[model samples]
Target: MDLTYVVAMGSERSLVVRPPKLNSLVELLTSHGYSVVGPILRDGVVVLDFIEKFDEALIGVESAPRPGEYRLEEHKGAVFGGPVGPMSMKRWINPPNRIAWSARPEGDQVHVDTPKPRGPRAYLGIRPCDVAARTIFGEVWPGHPDDLVIVAECTSVGETCFCSSMGTGPAAGEGADIVLTEFGEGSVLVRSRSDRGAVLLARMNGAAATEDEIESARSRVAAAAESMVRSIDSEAAREALASMPDSAVWDSVAQRCLACANCTMVCPTCFCTSINDTADLDGVVQRTIRWDSCFTPGFSEIHGGVHRDSVAARYRHWASHKLSTWWDQFGTAGCVGCGRCITWCPVGIDITEEANRIIKEVAHA
Candidate 1:
């Protein structure tokens, strides 16, 4: 590697190294027995999936996201220009559909076996808010500690991004094994936060980064932070929602909501699921679990009928659970402020705007 790519290394963790040689990193991680998963453009939208090479990744593509509208735009050399897409990291870790267990009937006895996970997976280009969301998910679906988290500092913020108010960031703050900051033109600032990360950087043989190079990277992050346009006071929203369960905001939000469940599927931390079994000719059955959304009427179904009969009731349950009761269940709010729910919602409902309105109403009350 060139001397310009080199930077300082420290036992205390932060080190600067090569800029955006993402393909090489993919190769290295794959060789080290990790299933390399990263961002890629498919059908004019970015989705997180298993990527074999860096070229397959969305290196120069950007996304224009507004409430209920998303368009893919090409940016020739601007990697990391698009903030996030509809698919969150949840798709890979806690898949939408997976066989929970299988059972076969032989005479009067049944044989059953639960599916096991494959090798460790490495996630590239993850943002800080997504990292926080994953931490919230870990409380439910625990993964290995050694699973590498390669976080990228945002070079540009999305219009719907509210990570700033969530304190999760345009810049990744902890929970990452390795962090990357893009300084444009294929130059990136790399930092190894863990011993495993340090070992990986040492193998690259990149030169030390100078003081000026580090400062330049910081400036880029600051600019991205200032560019954020959406924000929500999560704490105040939680309090308001908790205090006003019978608030009229539900009817208002429901009028705009389609009960499509797109928001829950796109949310990185939403983890509701349902289980069912299927049988074939030989009396073989496979029980599977599929992702379930609260917006669906059957999700709250009981013996007589669905508990949440109206769309307004279902919407209320979803939002109230997300901001209010989620704290009592998960010890933290279930939202990471990725804003996927806003951009992908067919009706252009903005969660942050709704949250602020709820807070306003509660204050007036």
Candidate 2:
């Protein structure tokens, strides 16, 4: 349980663990004082939640995602059958509601207290796109150093996924501590990307993977990337948004958009928040921070009036910020191509389609 072992021995080696042995990984994490969270079946969908055992995870569950549609179907004998669920790593890192601080009157003095620190946590079975999303999110809201990230490389593509175009996945990227690739034959290839990951992996005691086994697992991930149907050129989309503010595509999309903030809520990278303060009769004042959306009128409200008064304007601002202006502020696009926005949106408003439309129109103009 001593996690301070930082020497990365055999960091370049790939290890193979049989499916039944996966439970040991969870036990190992728990023994090391890490709270493990992974995908679980809830309300007929896969969602990220705490898991005490490996059986609690959605092992054979695959997600069917389309514009305005999402379903969890059984994929017999497949591990990590889905590309991603509706929830992302954001929910755990930045919760929906959190107490910033509290102040109480104590006999002619005020006592202020901040929330207690959360202990170390491990995210198991996280998808590569979400791994990328977590990295982008950290730029705005820093993450804990003690948290561990275990990424599951995609072997099957989702209908709305576009991570290939975004250069985020199918294969695990740089942020992951441990990367797992399931071959659908009751075995998984595991690789460590960091010193902590290497130390933990060594404890799993998995056998060294053969070159053929490693090549086959990587080939499956490559096939997943090629099979993706939806995509948008990030550079072109950025240029399109900057050049065509008055494009008719905004009005057309606004007609279908309800401005209910579903897209922003489901988006992995949207980080807008609002702070509220409440006081009780007992002279206790509590301040809390909660997630907010740009689609909300109050979000753009100033001293006089709301800046984005119409649905068209609000939609324009959101899509622009995600694909174009985000680069100006963060030096990277805000979206990681998880496709949650398209799947969860009530009206099936596809950001990729909308961005592509702008790009098409700008090309002819």
Candidate 3:
């Protein structure tokens, strides 16, 4: 082991040694009764949702370039676990378009369609940035606008992320219980920093590590942080571009934009949504929610009007919010820089590339 992978009960409660291999490591947790959830290739993308078992899942999985191109193929044996896929924290925590409480007609009135209760969940494979996103999400979802709704406790699993740039990634998980890392084939490194996390790891088995193993895990985390290729000085860039909302940047992107909502949909933090209703055969109604994008023609439609009648206005709002207003509203930038937005933008609108161009143009002039 190159780093301290496992920390046992007793002494200082710090990192111990030699990360366990994937399966052996997982066996430790599962045997101890903690359910493990992480990434799986689904619908052609490596998404962060739930998985029943590791049997056929997490195998032959791969993720390609970002800013949002996710072309995953099956690659065998101790995969790098790749970057945070196009999936975001929303899938696991928010339960997309949750009924927000549904409704059904009572004999003479309407009754609320209370959602099924779900409880403590342990998820694996979330990148550091998503963890930060989960924290950011908490502020918006549960505190002010809505009531306290604690979705789950992510007490176990691997941490492969580079949210450092956004001050959210690179594995600073005050929000996570157990952060998992793959040390070698079939082996994993579980480090529990919190009480809940420690309890979960206590159930898993692996001989306590010698000094050698602990160091091994540390090295791997350092490597993971440095290995990140997708990052932006989100704070700096956002500040620089803040006053340029009416600049030529939006128009440039609009020229190449397809009005496709792909970027917003795949983004982990883009939370805009559209709601619609369906009537049953009996003329009853039900509501459904699907992802929404500013690029869409109707997104900004106003009374007999669209507030953003021009493609420029619509696109400008998105970039500005991601780079600007998001901070005002949530005290954080809306973008996590997962790169999914770039890879899947259909016409391939590279936001970083666009930002650079705009900055350069401004500086030159």
Candidate 4:
């Protein structure tokens, strides 16, 4: 396996390689001291989970199809194991629980305890939509917190994603240190997109890609993007939803809504978080941040007691944020249209179906 380095203009340095097997890939990373994690088929859903070693997992090499309603069987034909199954990036970025600090109170002096992060970690399998969601979140986390300091891993996108339509991805090739795309043959196309990535690729000896192989990697991405099923017209959607703020579209859907945070949780772009301080009887506070959703009743509490007192309004906020205000706030729509929300909503609240209705109503209005 030879490595081909591709450093596109205005982009990070990346590499493309064709690995003989999964272990070789892991061996290349672990030998360089990077901890690897990827998709694991556990608890029934193929999810992004920790892979102790290369032979430990290849779940990410398995992709889901049509919708997440059913996963495409794992084979030479399918890989790029979709995104994390509704778990917040928090699971990877922020350690499950960390003791922020510990202090000892002496007669008049207080001494605090400090702890450093474990080390760098790499997520083996990632989806393009989730990568796009991460790009949006990266901008939101200003002055990057020390907790979000894990070394980059990677994802394999699916045919069901519409990240490219949102100016996001089907190719999350830029931000990662190492990315693996399963090709038709039993070979995995590995590419490095950064200096951190270069160092990682250089370790693969034979598998480090060559300049010519980079073109082949590009072809695979171009072809896969063409195969994706779901899509949204970002330009039209932004224009249509921008003016129809108070349209009946949101309310109509609320009648059948379960008010569950399914959409937000399943949404890779969603970064709403809630924190709580657990206090001991002695008045010590243990602060922790948890993922939050706009559909949850408490998300909009304000001075008037509550601004969005109705389910319809909250639902509107969620929809409008995805289709409109998120662009105003974050410079892009909050959704990459992975359709996970529709599949996992329990009640089957199709965002695309709802958006179409709203667009139609605005046309009539």
Candidate 5:
């Protein structure tokens, strides 16, 4: 995998690779000591998992995602079919549960041991919305420079997708090293966004994309954006949520919300974590970090009592933080509009609908 040819080539131009040739790219990554992870069909749905070959990827299968439901169907139209699945890049970058460190008492001296570092990871077939979510995750939990981001720009739109409204997708945005847009049949347009990506592209055997092919790819992405029916005005939603703390919509949503934290669990940008400490009888102590959700009553526990004791308050906090105060804190909205929260929730709580309701209420008042 000599990448010096990239420097020799000088120009980083888009190329069109046949679908079957993607395995060569995977092999190249593996040769460079990268553990390639891509979308694969599991339990009747597409999920991100480790892959050694491109055929293992969940290609030619489109996902139909709606509120409270998800279904997969065969579609020979594109290579990578779905927008996204329940899992995001967060699961690999920041795990659900991780042992931060462990300590042992050794002859009146305390010894601390941290977990070993993982090898470089290559995220393949990642959607643009999840790419944006990964950017947000980098802001809070920064440190995965070795990770390679290979984005699969959305050519097909899902029922619940709203990434266009969030200004995050349909086309791949920042944080991606390489971008791939699969056109009908076997052709895929690949572009390099970073030097490392250029190196990979240089090694790949492919023809330079024609001007017509590029324009066609762009048109497909634009069509996907236009097809999105669900949306939220980020600025308006932020203002609405900030102004209405006592809005009855909270109570209404709370009535429907099960407070099961399924939304938070599936959300790509929800990085709340809880720390747990345990000691063994042998005097070894371990500290672990696990994913936590604001929907949980214990999440807001205090000396007096739980701050957000009511389900309504909890719902309000989660929604407001996602669309409102998160701007003040992170300079960006926490929600990337992937619609996983909506699709995976048992009762189908739509964030865009709630945000719009809040905005409408504020306007009327």
Candidate 6:
């Protein structure tokens, strides 16, 4: 299959390819020692998992996700219908239980060892919202491979989605090797952003997309963004949180919150972590770093006692950090607006609503 490669200004190329050729793209990445990880419907939930084949990739399966309610609905013959789910790229690459290093103490000298770095991993069907989260997380943790981002633009919005408000997507931004836009009809508009992506395109042998096809892709992405029913006033939200640290709204929100930490766990940008030392029966001690949530009691532990003892205090800290202080640290807000925190919360605690509520109350006060 010989195909023409249309060179753009710098290093960008666009190709229109048929659906089955997606498998060829996967094969190419695997041949280069990349484990292809993408969306799969497992146990009635769309999650990021290993992709052995594109047919079972769960691409067109749409998730009817609301605050505290979620179910999968089949969108037959359509690919890439589902938006962001409870899982994100963070689960596959960064991981929750990543071990930084292991040390064993023998007499006066201690032996230290770190886990060997694994091969490159390719994340297929990743949304633009989560891509934004990954970009933010990469600034802090810094050592993952660079060749593995394959973004998929959303064709439809989820019930709780608000990525459009965050300006992160419905369409992917930069930092992707390959970006796929599935516009139904068993066709996909493929854009290559790097040299590796160009190689994969050459293998698939796709032709340069027609101008009409590119226009159709743009229209699809725009429609997806407009279809989103939820949005937040992020600028107002920042001002509200910073001004009202002792806002009475925190007490109301806390009463409904279970403090189960489900929101933080599902949040793609949340990077709070904790470390602990464990000893085995074989007289070997190992230290491990694991995901931690600010909602927990021990999260703010000190010599005397826990700092944020009340649920209200913990909730305040969580919201404030995500909307306010995170900007001070990263020059941008921590949330990517995927709304997984809203959908997965047992009580349907919508962060966007809470942020708006805070702004509303503070303005009146």
Considering every candidate listed, which one attains the maximal TM-score? 2
Per-residue lDDT, model 6, residue 347, is: 98
Better of 5 and 6 by TM-score: 5
Residue 190 displacement (Å), model 6: 0.4
Per-candidate count of clashing residue pairs (backbone under 3 Å): 7, 0, 43, 19, 0, 1
The lDDT of each candidate is 0.79, 0.84, 0.58, 0.59, 0.85, 0.79
* Candidate ranking (TM-score, best to worst): 2, 5, 1, 6, 4, 3
What is the overall TM-score of model 3 with all chains considered together? 0.79
* Order of models, best lDDT first: 5, 2, 6, 1, 4, 3
Residues 1-365 of candidate 6 have per-residue lDDT tens digits of 12122212113444445444567767778888888887777788888887766645464468778999888877653465477778987776568997778778788777888989777788888899988888887777653665488888888788899999988998888778778776646467777777777667666654567777777778989998989998877888878899998888899998999999999999988888899888777566777889999999999999999999999999899889888888888988888899899999999999888888899988899
lDDT of 2 by residue, 1-365 (tens): 01111111354655544345566788889998999998777888788889887643466668889999998877654566487878888898888899999999999999999989989999998999999999999987767889999998998888999999999998999899988877746456778888888888877754567777777778989999999999999999988998888999999999999999989888888998999999999989999999999999899999999989999999999999999999999999998899999999998999999999999999999
RMSD in angstroms between candidate 5 and the native structure over all alpha carbons: 3.6
lDDT of 5 by residue, 1-365 (tens): 11101111224354444444667778889988899988888888888889998743455678889999999977665566577889999899889999999999999899999999888999988999999999898888764689999898998888889999999998999988888876656466777888898888777765566667677778889999999999999999999999999999999998999999999999999999999999999999999999999999899999999999999999999999999999999999999999999999999999989999999999999
Enumerate residue pairs that collide in model 6. Answer: 59-80
Candidate 2 global CA lDDT score = 0.84
lDDT of 3: 0.58
lDDT of 1 by residue, 1-365 (tens): 21123333553434444543667788889988899888878888877778888643466667778888888776654565377888767787778899988888878999887887688888887888888888988887766666899887887777788888887888888678777776645566777777787777766656567678778878988898888888888889889988887778888988888899999999888988898889988878898889999999899899999989888888778887877889989778888788888998998888888778889999999
User: Candidate 6 at 308: error in angstroms?
Assistant: 0.6
Q: What is the lDDT of residue 8 in candidate 6?
A: 20
Q: Which ten residues in a row have the lowest lDDT in candidate 3?
A: 146-155
Better of 2 and 4 by lDDT: 2
